[model samples]
Target chain A: MESNTVISIQNLVKRFPVGGDFFTALKNVDLKLHKGEFTGLIGPSGSGKTTLLNIIGGLDSASEGTVRVLDQSLDNTTHNERAKLRRKYMGFIFQSYNLLPVYTVFENIELPLILNKIDQANRIKRVNQAIEWVGLTNKRNSKPNMLSGGECQRTAIARALVHEPVLVMADEPTANLDAENSHNIMRILTKLNNELDTSFVFATHDEKIMGYLKRIIRLEDGNIINDKKIKKEDV
Target chain B: MLFKIALKNLLGAKLRTFLNVFVTAISFFMIIFMTGLYDGMRQHAKQVTIDTEIAGGAYWHPLYDPMEPILFEDSHSTLPQDIRSLVEKNKAVPILVSQAAIYPNGRIMPVIMKGIDPGQNIVNMPTNTLNNNKDINIPVLIGKGMANNAKLNVGDSFTIRWLDSDGTYDADEGTVVHIMDTENFKLDIGHIWIPIKKAQEMLAMKDEVTYVSYAIGEKKVKKSDGWIHRDVNYLIQDIEAAIEADKPSIQIMFTILLSLAAMGIFNAQVLSIFRRGKEIGTLMALGMTRAKVVGLFTLEGGINAILASALTVFPFGIILWWTAKHGVPMPMDYTEMGFMIAKRLMPIYSFGLIITTTILVFSIVIIVSYLPSRRIAKMKPTDALRGKTGI
Candidate 1:
């Protein structure tokens, strides 16, 4: 693996058990993600984009082949080790804004910092900064139930980035948002990617997200069909 | 981090958490209260027996058994020189017990005739009433129970018949001089007390007694001329044994109470884990180990115990304190059932009992909480994230 590569996957295959038989989810997936890259895996449902993202995020294991994320081989790592890796270096944003419903916006954003065992003083400062970055400073004390769809997604984004992780894997982050909220969310994520030099990998099929990605990998039927890089001026 | 989340979850649960805590607090209070009642009964019974009948101890003839009234005829003997000296000094009191019958209202009723020294004050009894009475021939002292049973009040006269030392029957006219209201039923029901001289003369048993009860603070008579020395513990063993025999029933009650509380917590935990699978997935996604998740839930249960203990202090504590101050009014007198329990039973709480019950309930709560949490370890994060986990 090169020094600039954040994730290196070679012939990665994932399968699930379905009634005494194997159902292939990802077929011989070969991919490499570099630092400071804005990438998206654009595919329809059942195309195995989420499965590949889960494998790279260390949430799932490959059935065969090796997956190296941030200079560590994820093929044989224990569950605790995977959790530690995710805690220290990775962030994840789900489509439905999976913020803990019991916690306020500020507390939800502060979760990753707390999990990382960051000092209280720093946690407060970082959580406030993340809230400001997401333009949710006024709604910091509001619980998830009280927030609008855009606000909830913003809180989830702030929570994902509070620790300034090297990699952020978002699975259809704007799926539940309107076109306006989708564009707004994509702009914030793009701004964060450029400012912090963080690598972003998203599994999405929304056309609104295509304009922000510097690289797009298309998949069909558990296999990658196209890989293309676009210039920033093309948008 | 675990404590904060657990506390937040409990607070979010609102009424569910309160219900579980309330049930646990109730269990805690009931166990302590019932145990205290039993302790109070045993202590009160022992103290009364020591003050009235047993005194410090007793030296009984070898064949004497209080439970066996049929053997009373063969359980009498003359006191030794040492015991006689103690009796002369008022440090001991001699008692003569014999199987006899009384003719009351033209009916033959079996009874135990006991002779006690009227002048000796070693035991708390109304024996002095039998001394120096010219109005009645044989002045007999009976208890309220015996009076009630015989339908004879004070100053009532009846015929007393007994067997002599030579196996000859004799009869005499006896008068109930004073009916004493005492708590010790052994000295009451179906027994009559007379002056020692009159008893000896009527029974032809010259200087013979059934047992010698020594005064409180008197040294144990090492040589009693082949008599058995019965201590206070031995004398009160029947009451203790009776209380012990009834413990299992109370234990069953405790188990039911504890199980009720434990089952409530267990059900709550199961529902919480099942409902919060998405939250669990998010936590694990943000990097919490399954063990920590399990600990978080278990700590939630522990906090339930803690909150229950707090509740026990507020409302339950006041109830317990009031009961300890003013006794619990029993529906009926227990003395009639041959138990030494008083009419108004007082509860006695001990430090050891409180600590033990607290630990026992807390431990059960934690265990039940953890039992449902072990499922978290088997849950797949992907399945949980999708809210697809079965249980």
Candidate 2:
């Protein structure tokens, strides 16, 4: 219940209907994320890491829980409201990068701003700044297909930050990249976190990713097995 | 931006996109072609009747009763001497003439021979009546088909063979002074025009006439005077009514065919939407609203319709013009009705038909786009990203 807490979840449960039967994806998950915190949710396959991340990001609804982000209750928000909230306060980076292949890097970065109805001139300025921050200004006009994996991920990060959101939810963002590209993306995310004071919540199973995060929450069979915080001194 | 993305996606799958456009274009082409034929037939039917201004007291078949049909036996049906005075007294009436069909060479090739005074013939015939170039002689004008079938030219001599009321064959040979280049009222291939005196002589009739025709001063006249203005329109209506009555079943068959073509267009659009399911899902996941997506597809459909329409116009226009100029010749049997069928069919360009077809095409595209776009819009972002198929 700290004043800096950006997301708070209580007994969150998500069940998806499969073959006409309900399958539990998340079981009574509880978590708290503070502003500017670099958190990782690490779990094996079918361990509810993605379901938990989706619920927090407003991309999916929890079957039962009290989910609050930026003082807004997800349980009662309309689809539009959730969309607007996500646009204003949250950004998402998917495992596939999801950069609109038809758009240039700059346009892809400017997408979230455009969705939020930001003026074109201001969007251009913010997008350029975000590109520069991610060290991808040189490739601003390149399409996602033309860029390398690390560059694509950098564009994704630029898109995530262009709207100046408070939090970024990345679901297995590094799952499709090589080790070197993964390291580069993590470095970019860490740098953005430090410079902009933006919080990041990652759902990942990579041990290398867990070692770099300020906190790690491990899940097993849809339940959190351990929630550990690492101090700056430990790293 | 969304349009750019959609276009890029469309272009990315070059083969698939080409196939879609090809199928759509073919369907549209066939639809336009079939509809054009119908339009051409309608125009051909209208032109003969609507374009010509015939100056005569109109004659109607018995059923329509637009005019009285006077059967010419000998000279009995001829106007009484006082009838000419009566026609002349009325300033509204002009020259009066009579006409009838004579079965020549049996019933297959009936020759239309009218009993017209040379001076009165000028008023009874259409403005562009065929005349002997040499001496302005009132000779029989044969249609192209009749001329071709009988191997008779403008100067050739042919005999008119008809059975008198006494059931005897009467024959007379006259020079083919003029051949009508124009299509007749019925759009039949064969037509024969002759001077009233010569026609009476050939048919062995004395002072008989089939029906009386007189010109009115003005183009517009009230039908209340018991005499219908003898104009090209009446001729056309007479022919059309006759043909329509003759082939009532054909019109119904064409209507059904047209309706089926329309349904084919609708089905094509629906199949196109179903085929692009993944692409629609991707677009929705990109935060495009259902309305915007629908607009995009509708625009695409409009583009296709316009392109297809343009593609169809040129060939159709040329074909129609050709048919209008060089009419088709029907068999000699149909000539008895004064039918001059065009060799080529000319389509009537109707804005209503084009607009209706365009709207139908667009609506089908929209209807097809609707369910998919709505389903995509309602999809969960995570589910869309996972590439879940929309049922």
Candidate 3:
């Protein structure tokens, strides 16, 4: 357990029961992520990238292995403890930009702070900062139904970062976005990661998205075939 | 904060919330109306009986049984002096009842002959009509119901034949002097009233009366030997038993109303659990526990009922207020049906009735709201996140 290691997975195995026999999603997968690392689980579909990402995000548990997030043992922690851990230290960005359809952009951004039970004054301040960071302050009153894909994804990013979590997990964040909006979203994530020193792990197979990552962990058929740090010159 | 979130959700699902709340509010208004109607009818009937028949209380002979009109010939005992003194002071009346046969327009019908003091003002009866200051034939008082049944009007003559104390049959011609409308069927159907002395002589039961009904003026009457002192409640016991007997029928009405309301809410909640899987998963992913999600949905459903209550209270209030102030005329004449109900009954609503109805409707709505939400607790956040659960 290094001081900088926020996520540590060892011999992690995840199996889903298909009919009667089990289908292995991840087999003895091992990974470690440090503070401020912009990493991507680069793999094709059914390659266990999302499965590993879910285990690291504390949304799912390893079937037969040890996993740690923010130095807390994931296998031993209760669901409530994991929820609290997610609330206090983790942020998530789904591929579909799962913004609450009824709430305004401002309200969606304020949701995480509300969940953390932060006082109104502090919540307003943080929400305003997050909204500005995503450049959606002008559209703060717009509900998700009226927002464009780019705006929705940006609002999703603001919601994820509003509480200033220690880690952010994104799953196919650019899947529904145009190439331009995809790059725009990637740039925002990169800026937030660099400026806030918050670690990020994105499960994306898009090469364009992978180009923005500082490290790429290529997974193939439930195994990590390649793990390497990208050089600034690689971009 | 939880309430605010729930309020927001309820407000968001406009149609679903509206239908459930409307149904719930319908149940609320119905229960209140029904109980109030029953209560109002009972209260009015009881008061009418007190005014016309049983004033405050009555003293009945131990052997007297009003239900068995045939036994009235043997049921009378001498009125107690305490009651006789009250009658002398115009605070009581000695009533003698006998069974007789009447022939009107060649139509022979059974009648329960009643005797009352023509001068008594203690009861609300129009017995003064029995005076018939200058009439030659025996004057009698009949209720509108009996007059209608017998086709007898004022000044119309009929023959009444009955057995005397010696078991001999006697016939007399009686002229109807007045026809009164009373709420009590006992005084209306097949009943005729004559002067107490005339009835006593006709029945050959001299110095004996069936019972002495008196107005004691809030003072309790002491039970005397050979007499049964019936209080106000005891006097209305038959009515209470009638209402009590109708309670299960009333309960069925409530059950149907509540069940329909519950079914509406249940349908909405089941749909919500299935349709809002992604939203629920998002909330769970945003650090809301499965319990909180259930609470939020349940609270939302409860708020639906409360909102419906708010929306309906004013409209229903006006309706109840109108019914209470004016009255609701019966669709059919209840008097002819042989039931004791006023022609136009003014509904009486009580604070307890409204509150109890609200509590019951809200309780049922909340319980209906929660059962479907329990399924939310079993959904896995990951599967719900993908909108793949509860399909």
Q: Which is the better candidate, 2 or 3, if ranked by DockQ?
A: 3
TM-scores of all candidate predictions against the true structure: 0.84, 0.75, 0.89
Displacement of residue A78 (Cα, Å) in model 1 is: 0.9
Candidate 2 positional error at B112, Å: 5.0
- Tens digits of per-residue lDDT, candidate 3, B245-354, equal 87797678767866776676667667766788888888878888777878887888778778878865778778888888998888866776788888888778899878
- Residue B334 lDDT in model 2? 35
Encode model 2's per-residue lDDT on B180-290: one tens digit a residue: 555544322444666655555555555544444445443333332332334555555665775677455544654564456445555655566555554454444434555
- Tell me the spans in candidate 2 whose CA falls farther than 4 Å from its real position: B1-37, B50-70, B74-112, B115-141, B144-169, B173-182, B185-193, B202-235, B239-341, B351-362
lDDT of 2 by residue, A83-193 (tens): 667768888887877776657898778777776778878988999899988899789888888998888888888888888789898988899899988888898899889
Query: Clashing residue pairs, candidate 3?
Result: none
Candidates 1 and 2 compared by TM-score, better number? 1
Candidate with best TM-score: 3
DockQ of each: 0.58, 0.28, 0.55
Clashes of 3: 0
| Positional deviation of residue A28's Cα in model 2 after best superposition, in angstroms | 1.4
Runs of candidate 3 exceeding 4 Å displacement: B11-20, B61-63, B74-82, B128-136, B144-157, B175-179, B197-209, B216-228, B244-256, B301-312, B346-348, B389-391
- The top-ranked prediction according to lDDT is 1
